[model samples]
Target chain A: MISVAVDAYGGDHAPQEVIKGIEFALRENSDLFVYLVGKEGELKGFIKGFEDSFRKRINIVDAPQVVRMSDKPSQALRLKNSSMAVGINLVKEGKADAFMTAGNSGAAMALAMFTLGRIKGVSRPAIATLLPTLEGQMLMLDVGANVDCKPQHLLEFSIMGYVYAKHVAGIDNPRVAVLSNGSEPGKGNQLTLSSYDLLSKSRLNFIGNIEGDEIYKGRADVVVCDGFVGNVVLKVSESIPDLIIEFLKEEIKRSFWYKIGFLLAKPAFRVLKSKTDYSSFGGAPLLGVRGSCIISHGRSNGVAIKNAILKAVKFSKEKVNDKIESAMEGCFVLKELKGAVRT
Target chain B: MISVAVDAYGGDHAPQEVIKGIEFALRENSDLFVYLVGKEGELKGFIKGFEDSFRKRINIVDAPQVVRMSDKPSQALRLKNSSMAVGINLVKEGKADAFMTAGNSGAAMALAMFTLGRIKGVSRPAIATLLPTLEGQMLMLDVGANVDCKPQHLLEFSIMGYVYAKHVAGIDNPRVAVLSNGSEPGKGNQLTLSSYDLLSKSRLNFIGNIEGDEIYKGRADVVVCDGFVGNVVLKVSESIPDLIIEFLKEEIKRSFWYKIGFLLAKPAFRVLKSKTDYSSFGGAPLLGVRGSCIISHGRSNGVAIKNAILKAVKFSKEKVNDKIESAMEGCFVLKELKGAVRT
Candidate 1:
């Protein structure tokens, strides 16, 4: 049986959407148990429609305080015993196999790090997202996790990303690439150029520098960068569909002819869009931690929150953290990369 | 009469597309004179259909050498006798008001900086491109110029972008924002946070830090960042539309119903697409220089070439160079941000 902990007072929709998504997932999933952490009364109202057996399967952990989306991440732990922090504590104590949250990402990461700690030899943790590409789904790491990072941090991200894609996404011998301005070996500034050198020398299959255009090309299974650049790319990639959909709505509605085409093309558009949809893959899983954890979008709807819960369960089945720790030992990678030249 | 120097041999299609676009523009326009720079012999085939007045209005300045898109930008001055270089020289020497190229961006900026020199107090030059956004048009600066920059460099880019949008796009008191990972007053890496602090103290209508999602919101006229981040955003933005179009093409061709919609809604789609076309804005203009210049895409078709030439003319008329020099007085705004907190 897989046990997953859900932060009830997490996302913007909170207990309402969270409870709905969890109940929806419970229809055919009999082996799964949930520990919903939030105020009992608030969650009780949200879970009103669930059957008694389903409600009984859900173990409630009292957490009255909620983390606001806008709250500073640094302030999370000090407001100790918060819903998000308490939820993460369950994973650390092994009460749950994996913890999932749609709360403030910064606070979630902060509490996860402080509570669960990191996998041995892993200097820092990284959030790895499976980005849909032309060739296949690629792994991009540190999208929002350590915003300001050293070149070494990027090298570590590549290792974690490569391991995730190989173990979780089922790609073997994943090719890792450092995101840079140009494709040339020496084309980037200090952060990228140095990271490129280290990544190239690591045990993983390392491709040279990759431009932003090749991001969707699946040129590499692992594309690593600092949080700032990665976040910008993620936002731009995510928002493009929203922007296109908005433009199409105004265009198709303006005329009868276009409306016919939009209807016919809707299925194909949905398929292509579904490939890029983050919900299909659940949430960005935090790698390099002692325990498994997944961070969902703070504004995730019912469909997305349900997927996040399943992804957390999958993390337990795969034992992703164990594989990452073993891989680090066999690959004394970063030490061997000290002689590498950035340019 | 505005006379624009057109580098006929600059882009991929060369004299054919450049000549056709110019001829097409001339048939609809009467107040413009064009200096077509290339080998006179090469222009014969493409120019055969136009009348004498059209031919005379489009004068050929014979210069044989064409710069390749792959050539090092630093090597631009060594090829001073080439067609691309000579055409731009005409602008600097007062023979033509502005210079435009569809051939190579690096080459164009190198020649523009070499011939025109930097405006006083401008350490590095920048290029500005108008991105289509939901709220309205947003001006992004340093699209290709300085790959590595200081916080003050971004402050200078803000002022230049602010002026360009105000003077050319007709936006008043154009709100400026430094691109960052979060909207918080102090977020992002050291570079963005510092840049934000400097922008906050600037004379331009500086707004606070803006995340990538808000970029398309059209909340700010000038969005400032280093060339590295700007280039990635610009490249990804440019590639997304083509990617979607490719997906649409494959899907529409497979299904009969979707095919009908593709035809009927085709016109509306075309109009909406034309609005997003970067060529309509001409080219990414190299700013902070003493003379006007426009850098076109290397893969530019005939229409893009013509638009680039026309945009150069507009830059000349707007006297963007002189105005940029005036904006430099506010360049020292970063000094006010020197004591900013590291955290």
Candidate 2:
């Protein structure tokens, strides 16, 4: 049975939703076990609400402190007895196969790096999030981690994203492209321009540069960019559906006929919402780390948490970290080749 | 009478839409006269198709060359006899009040800088595009002008964007903000982190940092960023409706009920499209230059071209350049104070 560490006191709807998510995940996957890490007294009450069968699969690990949302990563790191740190420790101590949290993202990253550590040959770990597009879903990496990146960092991200998309996303020879201002090979600023040359020469299926407008057109399986640019793109795309709905609400209020049309078109709107919904993807995987760690949305509910647990289960089973390490070996040889070409 | 220089052979629709746009602008504003800059024979043929009364207001300048979209800005600059150059020359000689083009944006910027030059105290010019939001329209600058910008350049953009929003956009004391990964002050990469500090002490109504998602939330009247981030946001937002509509089309085709709902909600959809349409705002203005220049879409139709011409007229009449020059002076004084604080 696969074991997963769950930060039971992480998200906005913690304890309650975290307990519910554990139950939901246990129901969906029979061959799974969970170590629910949180305050013993608070979790015991919610644990009592669940059935005996679910309680049998779950084990509570006592963690006295909680990491507040506003707490800095440095402060959270000092809290050795915190729920986030204890859960990550379970993964490090071989008590769990993966760690899942919806709590302070920076803290989670810090704990993962401090505990399980980065994969061999990986300089920095990155967060990869899935975005919805017309052609289906595409993976974008460095969403909020590693704000300032060099050309080599982006090259590593492309390799890591390629491995994740291939093994986890289940695409054969995933098409990888760097996010740029224009689609042309020579386009983009300093970082993307140098990364483009490296990505093109790498062993992965690099498909040159892709413009921002082409992202939703399902152009590439994996799109690579700096964390700052990727974060902006992710946030902008996330806000589109809500902004559209808000605009439509105002438009419908203006005329009587439009109101009736909106009522009838509610199903179509539901479909659009489902396509762009975050709950379906569950969490963003902190790629390049030694162990599987999924950081979920802060506002995530039971369903989102459950989906994240399922994703963690799949990621552990895929042995993506092993593949990432090997990919970096190949990347090192390519770097040598690039150096040779320069001389 | 206000004389506007129109590039007859610039966009995909070329001399045709250019002439139609001139006709449309002339009809809209009686005080407008157009210098149709293109090959003499081609423009005269189109001008001949119009009535004698309309033809009287149109003057054709013989320019035998055209700047291809693929040509480099440097290469286009060498084409002294090109329509883009001829049109900009008209503005330089005071033969035209403002210049309008649907040509290569880089070429247009280069020509404007090469001919009219930057305003006094302005480090570099920027392109400002108006975007639709819940709180009506807001302006975003440096869309694609300077891909790599310093803290000082962004500070200049904020000043210029502030002046344009105040004068042309008609907002009193517009709320100006810098775009970052988060709304907090210390939440961006190296560039935005320094820019946040600089913008806070400027003379304009600076409102700290804003995230990408908050842009459409009607958070600020003028949003500033490096051209790269601004371009990506502009293109992504511009493509959102198309992607949504494409996704909706597939969803509607999946079921009969959805198809009917879409048909009924067609009016509401029209309202949504009109609100987000770029044609409504005419075109992006190349701000901070010595003279007014409007860069329209390459795929501009007659209506879009006409609106661009009208926008150029208003921009010139408003004397936004004069205001931009003065704004930069205020910015210089503020920079001195900042430098003094450092010492």
Candidate 3:
């Protein structure tokens, strides 16, 4: 059994939905053990409904403090170890195989860095998330971690992300790309230009630079960039679908004819909404860390929290740490290959 | 009669749809003169079907130069006395009330600045596009003009965007917001924090910072930011709906029942599509310029072009320049207020 520590207070739904999501995840993998961390009272209130065997298998660690959505990343991190941080420490101490939290992502990264520690060759750990596009879901890393990233850092992110895609996402020889303003070899900011050279020289199948518009085109399986731009892209990817839906609703509401028409399209609307759902995919995996930790949205539901734990369970079994280490062991051979071609 | 210069070879459709759009605009306003700029051969081929009255109204300026979308912004501006440049020069020369193009936006901004200087107190101009949200269309500025902008530049963009929203979009006391990572007093990057202070101090009804998700919530009528974020938002806003539409299409194609159901809900789909229609709003307006210049989509049709021209006509008569100059005159007051607040 790959035991995982889950912060029950991390998400908006908190212990209630998070516990329920854990229940669902437990159903999928009967051998999975969850370490629920939060306020004893809140955690107990939700845990009361489960059976004795389930209760026996599940565990709780008291953590009264909470980090709010309004708190600064650094300020939140400084608090005397919230349930999320404590849960991460459990993984670092080898009490759990992996760590999961439907909590503040910034805090998650900080805790992972402080407790679990960064990989040997990795500069800063990156948080990658899956984007369900027209073709299929692709991996986009450094989504909101490490805003000011070096070119070498991006190369490592690409390697780690490439491995995740190949093993976890079942993508064979994933097409890795350095996200940029354009697809040209010489395109993008200074950071991306140098990263492009490193990526092109690597043994990993390196695609040329991918543009923002073509991100969803499914041209590249693994797309990498710094946190700032990546965060914008990630946020935009989520927001635009919502904007479209709202605009459609408003346009329909303006006229009676459109209102009646909207009712007919309800099923299709549900289907469209379903495609954008990332909750089932669990939280973002903090790669290049010694231990496994999946960071979910703070406002996540029971299922999303559960999915995060499920991802943690997978991370433990898949040997993500070993894979990331192996990927980083080599010098960017792709860089040498890339230098051969004209810029 | 508001005479405007229309670059005939400006967009993807160019002379053909642009001329048709011009005709559509002329249909609404009988007294309109257009100086069509393009290659003589291409211009003749496009205008062949129009009547002599239409022919008489439009003065064709034969220029053997064509501006490409891929051309660098610097190169487009440096094309010493090119057709696009010459057309813009007409606006600067006071021969036209406004200029319209659907071509390279970078080149357009470069030429607009070099040819027609910024308003006196305005430090920089921004591209303000109408976003079709549930609360009706909101004006979003700096879509693509300035790449890396300072807080001062964003503040100027906000004021100009506010004017465009209030005067052209007809929003009385438009609620303006600076897009940020969060909706708080002290949130987002350094640029937003500084811009927030400047905007809050202004007479324009400045709402505080808004998160990316709140965009669909209709939190404000004018969302201002630097061009990089603005362009990313705009492009994402354009792409996501199509992505959803594609998903729905494939889903419906799975079975005959789904296909039949889709047929029933065709009207609803149309309603949703109309909500996200960038064309309904036509091109974005280039604010802080001496003259009204509309930048339409490269993929715009004659109808969209016509609507764009009509919108430009409103700005031209609204005496946007007069209002902007008056706003700029108050810069000294604002600077003094900022100083007072600091002390």
Candidate 4:
């Protein structure tokens, strides 16, 4: 049975959705167990409300403090007994196979770095977000982990993204590319230019630089960039569909014929929304840490939380950390790249 | 009457679209004149095809060479008699009110900076692109002019974007925001972190940091970032609708009902397409240069080229360059930020 620890007092929905998600996960996967890490008194009554047989599988651990969404990562770190900290400790102590949280993302990353630490040869841990493409989904890394990253950090992100795409997503050979203004190998800022050289020499299937317009056209399975660019790309892409729909609504309201057309095309719009929904992917994995860590959105609901739990379970079963550690050992250039910080 | 010099031997459509665009512009606007800059032998026959009344207003200026899209800006600069160079010279020599090109953007920007120079205190010239929002269009600057930029460069972009938004876009008290990972002032990488500080103290209608997801929500009238981030955001946003349509077509094919739905909603999709189309905006203006220079896409068509010519006429009539030069003079902080190159 795979064991998972979840931060009960995390996310906008919090204990309500987190509790529903755990119940759903347990019902969906019979061989899975969970440790609810949060305020014991508050959560005990919630768990007791479920079926007696389901209640037997859940163990509530007391984490008196709660990390508010507004709190900074540094402030959250000071709360050693908080749900975010205690949940990470569960994975670090080997009491749980994986840790899942929808709590403060910066706090989660900070706690993971402080407690579980980096996997053997990994230089920087990155957040790998699964973005939908025309054909399927692509993996974009360093989403917000390290905003300012060195070329070597990007090389490591590419490697980690390659491994996760191969193992988790099951692509035979993932096509990897660095994001740039132009598609040419020489067309990029300083960070991408250096990362391009490192990626070219690596064992992975590294394609030349990819322009932003080619990202969703299914040009590459893995797109690597520093966290700053990656974050902007992810957020901008997320915002477009909503913006388009808003514009379409206004256009429809202008004409009686357009409103009728919108009604007829409701099914097609539903399919589009479902395909782009983040809840389908569950959550993004925080790669390069010693323990398995899955970080979901702050506003994530029950379904999103459930998917995140499943992703964590998959991460544990695949031994992704072991594979990453082994992959890092083979990266000969990382030795020289150590402590190379580029502002 | 505003006279606009257009590079005839530019873009994929070349003299065909360029000539067609000139005809369209002349037909639309009665008070406009154009100097068709390219090889006289190739363009004279094209101009002769127009009506005698229309032909009377068009003049052909012979530029012996054409700047290829692949040619380096430095290499293109050597050809002083090329269409790109001669067109810029028309504006610099006061022969034409504005210079417009659908040719090499890099070459156009380089020639503009070389010939026109900066607008007094301006450290680096920027390209301001009009991106569609739910309400209307917003201005995003430094699209690809400078790949790497300091905080001061971003500050200058904000000021220029504000002036353009107020004068050209006709927005009263335009809200300006710097692009960052989060909406908070302190939440960003080193570049944005420092930029946030400078922007907060600027005289412009500075709204705090804006996340990428909020860019198209009409959260701010002007969004500021380094050229690298701006280019990626622009290109990625441009590519998304195509990807969405491709996916929708595939989804539609999966069922007969979906196809029917797609057919009914064709009008709404058409409206959406027109709103997002780059051709509607014509071209991005290279701001902060001494003279008004408009750069269109290499793949721009007849309609796009025509719109670019119209945009150049508007830029010239607005005296945007003069306003920018005056704006730069009031910026007291720019003196210290003159040579601040981060990378």
What lDDT does the true structure give each of the candidates?
0.79, 0.85, 0.77, 0.86
Model 3 regions lying over 4 Å from their true place: A148-153, A178-206, A246-265, A331-343, B184-187, B197-204, B331-333, B337-343
What would the per-residue lDDT of candidate 1 be over residues B1-343, giving only the tens digit for each residue?
A: 7788888888777767778778866765677898888888877666877898898888888888878765767766688677889998898889988888887666777788888788876767887888888877899988767777788788778878877887788998889998887777756888888777677776678888888877887878889888888878887776676667776777677888878767777776687677767667668888887888888876677677778777887888888877767666544344554333111
Q: List TM-scores for all candidates, in order.
A: 0.90, 0.93, 0.92, 0.94
- Per-prediction fnat: 0.50, 0.61, 0.33, 0.73
Pairs of residues clashing in candidate 2: none
Candidate 3 local lDDT, A1-343, one digit each (tens): 7798988878677767788888887777889888888888878878888877678778888888887666667876777668877788788779899988877676788878888788766767899999886779899998776756677778788888988998889998889888765465644566788888777667878988887777787889999987766766776667777767666665566766556555655677677776787676677888888998888866688778778888888888989888877666664344454333212
Instruction: Highest TM-score: give the candidate number.
Output: 4
lDDT of 2 by residue, A216-284 (tens): 888999998888988888888888789889988987888776777677768878978878878778989
Deviation from native of the Cα of residue B274 in model 3, angstroms: 2.8
Q: Indicate the residue-level lDDT of B133 in model 4.
A: 83
lDDT of 4 by residue, A120-178 (tens): 76778999989988778899988887889888888888888988898889998899999
Candidate 2 docks at the CAPRI level of medium
As for TM-score, the candidate ahead, 3 or 4, is 4
Evaluated at residue B74, the lDDT of candidate 4 is 91
List of clashing residue pairs for candidate 1: A261-B261, B10-B103, B11-B103
Error of 3 at A37 (Å): 0.9
Report lDDT (Cα) of residue A164, candidate 3.
90
Per-residue lDDT of model 4, residues B40-92, tens digit only: 99888888779887888888999999998767789889999999999999989
Ranking by DockQ: 4, 2, 1, 3
lDDT of each residue in B296-328, candidate 2, tens digit only: 977788888899999999999999998888766
Docking class of 1: medium
Q: Which ten residues in a row have the lowest lDDT in candidate 4 chain A?
A: A334-343
Provide the clash count, candidate 3.
5
- TM-score-wise, the better of 1 and 2 is 2
Model 3: CAPRI class: acceptable
